[model samples]
Target: MSTSLQVGKILNNNNRITSGEIMGSSREGGGRGAEEDEFLLQIPEASAKVPKDAFHLAYIFYFTLGAGFLLPWNAFITAVDYFTYLYPEVSVDRVFAVTYMLVCLLFLLFIIGWAHKSSAYLRINIGLALFVLSLLIVPLTDLLYVKGTRGLYSGYYITVAAVALSGVADALVQGGVIGSAGELPKRYMQATVAGTAASGVLVSVMRIITKAIYPQTANGLRSSANLYFSVSIVVMVICLVCYNMADRLPVIQYYRDLKMQAMNEESKEKGPLSGSAWRSTLWDIVGRVKWFGFGIFLIYVVTLSIFPGYITEDVQSLLLKDWYPILLIAGYNVFDLVGKSLTAIYLVDNANVAVAACIARLLFYPLFLGCLHGPTFFRTEIPVTVLTCLLGLTNGYLTSVLMILAPKVVPLQCAETAGIVIVLFLILGLAVGSVVAWFWVI
Candidate 1:
């Protein structure tokens, strides 16, 4: 059989074994053996230089920037637009319910159809591309087609698109397309931080521009949305151009050589773990980094669902000004950038994965508590904002740590599956936490 076929089989078997373990089956021992066999199959028989693909870097930057632009502002824009116009009566519970429902549906689709696995990279890139396109088009649709019709459906569509984009981005990052399993290069994390920081700056600038250009508007949601779409379109276009140009670079040639070498190695392997070991070898890979996954889920549950709306609502209630809210958003992103950069660089350099993960997870508890009660404890602007900024920092650091640790929890072959599983938990946790927070509000 061909080397690719053999390696594919090993990876398939590994996946099966891992799934069994996740399901609480007792076939973990066999899973481990399958994993080892798959690993051996992947190693090249002859030493070869590692590929330094230029497109790899370009893609990393592209996706990293996409992440930055997508993560912080997507929902915020929707919320801003929705609340600015219609449904002031809509409770936070409804927001959480809508988001949770969409995420759950997507996760279900992922599991039942193996959609994430089947079209991993395609799904991710397409999703991001669509999000950028949607941001650009939605406003136009509102202007032309909808013509002042801003209802739940419009908000729902926008929110669904944004959330789906996030899901796909998370999957891609987890799949090792951007950064592989094991130790990640510092440059990648740096790109992510830089992208996030850039997004914050852009949003702030965009707000100013929108306010200046369209002073007649009561709220800047539509203007901000327009700016977001335009900026994203430009950024994505640049990324696509760079990605194409990168194909011609010498680095790509090196990468192709390395890839070919690995393929040759896999062709020679033949065993239970060879050429379809992914299923069987999955659990052994996960067992090594299970704690990291659990910690991540805990962090997400506390952070994404509960903290965001809590912070936004509290600050809005207190300050009651649009400018302050925008500043807070920018401040949070800036702190997040700094925190993520520091954590990624530090952990990549010195700390063990578990230690790094634990520290990151522990930091979330304080942030969570602050979000839960900081408003009540501190009635003043300086103190409340400070706590909010700290929460941002913690969130930034934890986000980076989780991204780094995710790939480590599984072998390279099944990195995609590992990412999918991790994201499943993230979605589940966020959904549950959002629901719980809504209940608390009630």
Candidate 2:
């Protein structure tokens, strides 16, 4: 049941998102012209005093949730070698990707439609539970059933089902977490977004560590795969505990009460958020944030198309031939973390420039193509490495910028919906990008 006071982060329109705190009475240009602003509005504090984040616990909780939600996909795909080794007939990685993305996109669509009727707290808890369940399936099944055997088609299907379950969990947690963060100040949003990049870096670093430590034999592969899911399960449990505790924090509750006050005032006048009224409001919020959503969409479409596919398959180095793609991926992830963190330092509040930068990312195509087709110098490791770093940097920063900016421009009441709608666009972009990667490079 929905709590009278919210159990997760939420948003209301306010001009007060500066330096990243959730509560304030002031608001920026909340109308259509918000898009035309010259710079982010001045700090303009609200009439009421803002409460502190209280030891940054709320901040840490949001960041952990962001990282936790993405870990399932990372765990599954990172352990791809074992899945393939166990069942050689099928393409394990591609199958898992298709199933997971499809399920996530579909569930996210359902969540967006019924967002007003549901609560972020319920969705997130259930999602986190599902994630733990999905992670357990892998290590447990391998231990009890597979027993280091090969050509186990039954085990393969079960693993794919777990991937699909994780996708459902992702759909539940990701939008709610981002939407929840949207209701708070900008720093929490920054933390949440940055944690996503941190997840990639964490997985990459762990993969490297496991590669260095483990033998290349079948037994070694099984052990490494088990480690990935075991560690992921521990993180998900931490996320669940941290997430439940978030709403109880003084800092988080302060903003929840603030948003509740606005909601109560609106409901008293409008006589509850009726279905038609909510649908109309949702459409308006969608209109307000569509351009920002487009920017997010383009960002993922570009990043995913080039990332694992181009880096993993198209390029090679004489010295780092086998390690080339691994190093390139690690570099991309570290720089992506750097880019997401940059937003906390200085956010580009102008919507026009943010969208334009996303469009500018189209240049990545030719530059990356040059790595394959252009002169030796352009096609070499240095150029590819530089371009890949640029790709991750642009992808991380622009995604963080758009995700943070979109809902803040909406009515305070509709901000959470706006954030979820933005996620709909993001998941769609990811799904499309995955498809495009399959057919890319002629």
Write down the lDDT of every candidate, Cα atoms only: 0.49, 0.81
Residue 223 of model 1, lDDT score: 59
Q: For model 2, where is the 10-residue window of minimal lDDT?
A: 1-10
Total backbone clashes of candidate 2, pairs 3 or more residues apart or in separate chains: 6
lDDT per residue, candidate 1, 1-442, as tens digits? Answer: 4433443454455433231121111111123235334444453321122234334664355345434434434444433543446434446334634564455436543542353235433544554465455455555665665444555566546644654554444344333233322222233434554465556556656665665576534345555555566666676556445434544454434333333333343344433343246444555545655655566566556655545565556554445475565566667766866776676346542225544554455555555455446665554556556765776676667656665556444434344455455555555556666666665441
Off by over 4 Å in 2: 1-49
Model 1, residue 30: C-alpha shift (Å): 41
TM-score of each: 0.68, 0.89
Q: Which numbered prediction scores highest in lDDT against the true structure?
A: 2
Off by over 4 Å in 1: 1-79, 82-84, 89-121, 149-186, 193-201, 208-220, 242-277, 316-320, 348-377, 408-410, 416-421, 440-442
CA shift of 429, model 2, Å: 0.7
Clashes of each: 40, 6
lDDT of 1 at 425: 55
